[model samples]
Target: MSDTGLHPGLVRPRPQRRRARSRTYSATVRTLGPLALLVLWWAASATGLLTPDVLASPAEVLRAIGELWGNGQLPDALTTSLTRSALGLLIGLAAGLVLGITTGFTRLGDELLDSSIQTLRTIPFLSLVPLFMVWFGINETAKILLIAVATTFPMYVSTSSGVRSTDPELIEAMRSFGMGRLALVREVVLPGALPSLLAGLRLSMTLSVIALIAAEEINATAGIGYLMSQAQSYARTDILAVCILVYGLLGLTADVVVRLLERLLMPWRTPQGATR
Candidate 1:
C-alpha cells in the first residue's frame, strides 16, 4: 500500500536486516586482517623464511613469556615500570590540568603562559634526556620526570582546546544567574572540556608507556627496558619480542581504561547499539 508498491512493514524489516548484516560483515573484516597477518607470520616462521635471530616465532615468544613469568622476572619488571608510569602520569595530569585551566579560562594567564608552554612542547622530550640526567641524575627521579614531561603536553593541548570550545552564550547565561568564578568553572567549563580531557588522558597514558621505554634505558637495573637490554646483550630475540609485546599490551590496557572512563563519565554519549 506504500509508494512504489512496497509494503511499509516489509521495507522497514529489510533495512534492519541489511544493517545487521553490514555490522556483522564489518566486525568480521576487522578481525580478519589481524588473523591473516598472524597466519602469514606463522607460515613464514615454519618455512625458515623468518629466522629466530631476525624475529622470534610466535610460539617461541609464547615460551619466552612463560619462562619470564615462571622465573618472576616479568612480574617484578611490570610492577616497577607500572609504578614509575603511574607516578609520572599523576604528576603530569595535575600539572597539565592546572596549566590548561589557567590559560584557557583567563586572558592574562593565556598571555603569560601559553606561548612558553607551546614552545616547550614542540621540542622532542627524548632530546632532554641528557639534561634530565645531569639535573636529576640517572635515578628514579630522572626517569619519572621524563615520562611526566612526555605526558604533559597532550593534556595541556586537549584541555585548552576543550575549554575554549565551550559555548560563550551558556557561560553568559550562567553569569547572569549569579554564578561565581569557581562555580562557573566547576559546572560549565570543566564539563564542557571533559571529552577533550579524557582524550588527552588516553594520549598521555600511551606516551607514558613510550617514555617509560626510553627512561628505563638510562642505566636502569630492573624494568622491562633493563630486560630488553640484557636480552640484546645475549642475543635473545625471543625475550626481546616478549618485551615488545608487553609494551604493546600495556598501551592497549591504558586505552581500554580510558574507554571505560569515557563510558562511566559520559553515559549520554554511548552508542545506541552498544546500549542494546
Candidate 2:
C-alpha cells in the first residue's frame, strides 16, 4: 500500500493545537479586549482623570451618535463627507497614476518632478488648507481641492515605487516576447503596482479626511467634520468624540473594502504581500 499524503492536521496533533491557539488569540483580541478598555475608560472617568466637560466617555459618544441618528443629521453629514472624499480620491488617483508612471520610467521626468514632489510632501497638508481657501474660496471646490492636493503625493510616491519594483524577471520575459513599450506598461507595470497604489490610497484617505475637517470647519454647513466643529463650539465633547469615532470607523471601513478588492484583483497572491 502506498499512502502518499497526509494533511498537516492529521500528521500531527500540533496543528490542531496551533489552530486552537489561533482561534483563542483572535477571540481574546476581538471579544475581551475592547470590553477591558471600556472598563478602564469608565473607571478613569469616574475617578475624574478626565473632566466630563472637555472629554467624553464611550457611552456618551454612543448616546450622541444615537441622538444624531434620530435627528436625521447624521446621514446628511455622512453624505457630504463621503461625496467630497470620493471626488478628491478620483481626481487625485487619476493624476497620481499618470505622474507616477511617467516619472518612474523617464530619467528626465524623474529629475524634474521627483525632488519637487518630495519637497511638496514634506509640507504638512494642513498648511495648505489656508492657501487653498484663499485660492479656491470656502466652497465645495476648496474642500475637494484640499483633499485632492493632500492625497496626491502619497499615491505618486507609491506608484513610482511600485512601478520600479515590478519583478525584473517578469519585465525581462515581456521584453523577450518583443512586446511594445505601451503594451509592457499596460500588461505589466500597472497590474504590478496595484497593491502599492491601494496602500497609498489608504494613506490618502486619512489625509483627505483630516483636510476635510480643517476645511469644513471654515465654511461648510454639513459633514461629520462640520458637525464636529459645531460640537466643539458648543463644548459638546461627547458629540465631538462620537464624530471622531465615526471618522475612525469610516477609515477602517475604507481599508477593509480596499483589502477585499485587493484579494479579488490579486487572487494568485499568497496571504502576505499579495497585492504588490
Identify the leading candidate in terms of TM-score.
1
lDDT of 2 by residue, 104-166 (tens): 866788999888988888998788877887888888998887778887888899999998888
lDDT tens readout by residue for model 1, 85-123: 999999999889889988999999999999999999999
TM-score of 1: 0.88
| Prediction 2 TM-score vs. true | 0.81
Candidate 1 local Cα displacement, residue 156, angstroms: 0.3
Model 1 sits at a Cα RMSD from the real structure of 4.4
User: For candidate 1, what is the lDDT?
Assistant: 0.92
Error of 1 at 22 (Å): 11
